[model samples]
Target chain A: MILCDIGNTYIHFCDTYKIWKNLPDEINKKELSSDVYYISVNSINEKKLLKAHKNSYNIASIVNLDTPYVGLGIDRKAACLGVENGVIIDAGSAITVDVMDAGNHLGGIILPGLAAYTQAYRSISPALEKRINFGMDFDELPLNTQSAISYGAIKSVVLTIKEIVGDKKAYFTGGDGKFLAKFFEKAIYSEMLVFNGMQISIDKALKKHKEQK
Target chain B: MILCDIGNTYIHFCDTYKIWKNLPDEINKKELSSDVYYISVNSINEKKLLKAHKNSYNIASIVNLDTPYVGLGIDRKAACLGVENGVIIDAGSAITVDVMDAGNHLGGIILPGLAAYTQAYRSISPALEKRINFGMDFDELPLNTQSAISYGAIKSVVLTIKEIVGDKKAYFTGGDGKFLAKFFEKAIYSEMLVFNGMQISIDKALKKHKEQK
Candidate 1:
């Protein structure tokens, strides 16, 4: 069985312990012979894959989790499912901070990612335009404009995450997850968190189908 | 003496206890006989005002403070000058958080203002676009997208300030000063902080001119 997570840019596939990615256009050229379960944010790409492959399932359709948040992204839902009790952080194009306790999604907040933080500063004024130093020391206040903005971006996000997570175990995922996880006293960095979530959802769906039969 | 703070959108004039604003275009139509001390971010408008009035002085020239921060805004310099020790927050197009202690400028960081925060979220994705509810409760994790983004913006900013200002008093100024000051246990909301800084600079400049003679 193969699990997939499709974003606007890339279509990621995970089979067992192996993971690979393909462009949306590349989906039509290759034949997906095995059963593929996928969750996608890109509807157009999802439709194209659905048309090309007969043995494909949109995992988002089957994944069920307890969440009070209305219109929570399927990707976030999948990530939350992988953890029973922890603060799940998905730091991609946007950084999402979700809290889960006793196997239920408590809710979450969204912050601009590192790139988005840089873009936000640049958009405010030309003087504020500076590259964010992700590795800047948060202990001391920055004395220069570049360091100031950089420290602001990194520190603000770190503080927000720390405030929300509290004593709960933190699970970090996505592109910049490892970088942010370094600041925490203890955080689990799992690259396949979303994929693991997809697997869990697929398992639950299959079990439900079997019980129905 | 008349004091003016020129920004991109509006020209704010403070005369003693009275304060008023004028559009950039309206400055030429009005005749000014009084000596105006002004700090401006708008160069064209500053030059135009300079040409129109010979008695006008750019207050940025006279203000002297101890700090290592480079390219700091004149308005921020003036705000810092108003307080002996405190975290000065200027919430306008961009929210600036500066730490001042015992008459020395310790440096500061900048974050996107409330409006900029909204713009940042909207720019991330179409689905993420929502009006930020500024008054949302921060104690609980937000269950809806609107509250989530709003809470994230407010809570992050508040936490950053709280982290930096620890035991020091907080001095809030600018357009959204009063609103943000409510979050802190004890904070001074001074509308004339920048103007006061300008006045202090003018007094110092006059004293130096006397000493030279």
Candidate 2:
């Protein structure tokens, strides 16, 4: 089976549960054949999917779940599916938290990412338009404007998350997952958890369809 | 005495305690003379003050308190002075809470105002960019995107203020002060509180300077 998780930045393709960072160039390669291909994407560029499909003839299926096409964020839903009963935090271009109760999903928090929040403030307030890098050792006493903003946003998010989760476990994923993990307790970084969750959702759906027969 | 409070959008002038919605065109008129003129402005042209001074020969004294320009918001300091021992909330372009204990000012909370919060979200997220009119009915469910945004911001501010004040009195001021007054246990809408505060500040400064003799 082949699973493809497409996000805003890059695409991840996995075969037999192992992610292939670099795909082989040649099409019709015998080793690339798989019984099933399940694709979930935020972008509906058919050409990209078709190119990947041509390389594997055993690909008997294809799925597209693009934005506005699929309704909600597929990655968010998938992240929720990956956890049994915990908060799943996705820290990418934006930060979102999806809470899962057993296998059921609950609505979560969505806010601009750290960079986006600071950038938006800078853009709106011409007097405060400046860039500053966020580091692990954020100054307790923020001396500059950028640091003050960065510290406030980061502290607010961290405190908010802590307040919401209480003693519950938290699962961190996405580009800044590892960075945030250090600040949160019971937080484990999982780069492919969202993709894994998508695969699990597809498998469950397929299984339910087969059982109806 | 003439007290003028120049805000982000409006200039409120008062002769004694009676508010004049518009500045008098003929300040030289016999009816317009005042012994003292205290002006507190956030974003008004300096020429208006000069004009006021030129017209009033009885304007024996003049005072102007610079706003948002001095690193801290003028509204904040004014709110601090308006209340003796309570939470002073300024719900205008931005919602700020200044906590005062026994007339001594403590730092406070600063967040986007009701309109600004919704507007910021709408601007950043294309899906939610719509104008919303907020209301007073706390139990009423939000029917649309605008109401939802308004409800969320209002609820957040109310909760934060309640938490901060606990058992103390609460004072509300600003353009949207009336709207927020309904949520607090004891909230009085004082449109000229900031101007009054400026007058008090000036009086205190003068008193202290005289005592140095």
Candidate 3:
């Protein structure tokens, strides 16, 4: 089975067993299996990928997330399914935190990621361009303008988690997941959460297919 | 004397007495004071403001910001002068928290303001643009995407304050000063902290001018 998840930046592809992240543009469709399930938040990117793999495999029924939450992306919904009851933080272009207790969706918050926060200011004030550098000490207060921005952007996530997550177990997946997970010892790092979730959805669909047959 | 501060989004202008914010593009150069002090983080905006008022005022020796830290904006310097032994939170397009004590500069951190945080994600993912709205309860976990963003953005400031400030005095200034000041009962809300700081600098400059005379 082949599983694919698309975000604002990159397309994540996975097999039922392993994962291939940030897949190249020229896809080698040879590795893909008979079953495929795909979900995306970027429509144009999704269309392009689907067009490339016109007749690749048997596509499974992708889960519908729009009904429950108007514009909740598949990546988030899938990540939620991957976890039972915990605060899931997707630290991608946007750092999103969703809390689920007893499989009931309590709520989620989406704030700026590191790059997004810096770009937010740099886009408006060109003077601040290239002013700040990342990979700083989140504990200490920064002296210069750029360093100040870096500390603020990075620490805001940790600070937000501390405020909202409280006693809930924290799980993370995304590009910056490892770096962010370093801040907290207990945060469960799930590098392939969305893929694990895809497998679950695909298995359920396949079982239903056999019953229908 | 005319005092002007250029932030990421708005230009705050204040005479020794009255103040004007987000001045119109067509600047009324008449009734202008001879002495003007200016500070800016946006170079282009500052250039335009200076160009418009060319030869209109002596541009009073803009308040000199004497600090070891480089790239520290005069606006921040002025605000520092506006307070004593406290943490200054400037909640503008960027939320900046600076610590000052005993007439010495400790350090500061800059985070994304509410708008900046939202814009960070909204700019990249247009789908997220209209999905989230502001004005949500920060204490409670939000069920919707927009409310989560709203709660995260606003509550982040409050959380940052609690983490960093820690028993220190909290002084807030900028557009969202009053709204954020409500988060803490003891937080001092200043409508024109930058302006007040500019006034102090101007006074010191004038005093030095007198001593030189």
Candidate 4:
């Protein structure tokens, strides 16, 4: 069985969070089992993956349960399916905070990432358009223009996530998962969210295939 | 005595925070005192104000205090003089949090206004870029994508201001001063920060004129 999750920055294939740089030359040469499941934010790679194993390639969206918003991404659907109850935060080009309760999706929010916050500050005020350091040490009282905007934006994201999770367990994923992990009280960083959900899906498909025969 | 402050969005004249839409057709016809004082972000207006009272006018920057960053705005310089100590937050096109202590400008931060924050988010992520609702009811757990980013950005500004103020008094000015004022425990909303500062400078300039005579 093969599992894949495509994001804006990288196409993550399997549980290691390893990026799939290019389509493999041959699907048969991959030497993997026939069953395959995948999800993606970038639609460009969707057709290529499906054509590789047209008969066995299963798009993860059709295997879903309850989703809060209509047309929610399959990647989020898979992430939501990873746990029965908790808050899942996927921090990438965009950050999403979804509250899950016993397989029921209560609600969620999507915010701009750290870079977006800083870029916004620059665009509004031409006087402050110059790029400033975002990696500066965190100071409760910002010492300069760069520190204030950068720290203020970062702290906002942290507080928002904390407010949503409250007493529930929190899960972090995506490119910025590790950075967000350290800030949470009981947050677990996982690369297996999409992959794990795919496992359950492929098993069900296999059972269905046997019954059809 | 005439006091004027030119901002990016509007020009404010008089000892109050009243915005001036245009230069009066005839300054001489107003029949006020000939002593004119002014400062501006737009250089075009600076010349107009200076031309009106070129014979006896005194530009504000000459009457001053210890400014931390060179080329600090006269509006901020006047705000620093409004209080001996504490932080001043001017929330307009750009929200500035300046630290003033014992008549010296320690330092400050410049962040984007509310609109800028939203614009930034839209630029980065096209999928979540659709307009949701920035004015939606506030919730601990956001109900939708729009509410999350908007409320999260707003709350961040509040927390950052609180963090900087600590136990000290926080003075808020600018267009959104009242909105931000509500979020702080010890925050005082004042329209007179810049105007009052200008008053002190004008007074000193007058006293110095007499001394020279």
Candidate 4 collision pairs: none
Least accurate stretch of 10 residues (summed lDDT) in model 3 chain A? A58-67
Which model scores highest in DockQ? 1
Worst 10 residues of 3 chain B by lDDT: B55-64
TM-score of chain B of each: 0.88, 0.72, 0.86, 0.79
lDDT of 4 by residue, B127-151 (tens): 6565535456665556556666666
What is the TM-score ranking, best to worst?
Answer: 3, 1, 4, 2
| Model 3 lDDT per residue over A16-120, tens place | 557666543655567654545677777777776777676433232455332244456678888887777888888887888887777766678787776777687
Better of 2 and 4 by DockQ: 4
Model 2 RMSD, rounded to 1 decimal = 7.9
Highest TM-score: which candidate? 3
Over 4 Å off in model 4, which ranges? Answer: A1-17, A20-38, A41-60, A63-73, A130-135, A198-213, B1-4, B8-17, B20-60, B63-74, B102-106, B130-135
lDDT score at residue A67, model 1, on the 0-100 scale: 86
Query: Per-residue CA lDDT of candidate 1, range B1-213, in tens?
Result: 789887655677887898776677777435466888899877877877777677888867787777888888888898899899889998877788999988988889888787777888777777778998867888788998898888888888888878888988999987778888998987999889989998898888889899999
> In model 4 chain B, which range of ten residues has the least summed lDDT?
B23-32
- Measured with C-alpha atoms, the lDDT of residue B89 in candidate 3 is 86
Tell me the tens digit of each residue's lDDT in model 4 across A74-170.
7777788778999988887677888899888877777677666667766665555555464667644555556666666676677778877888999
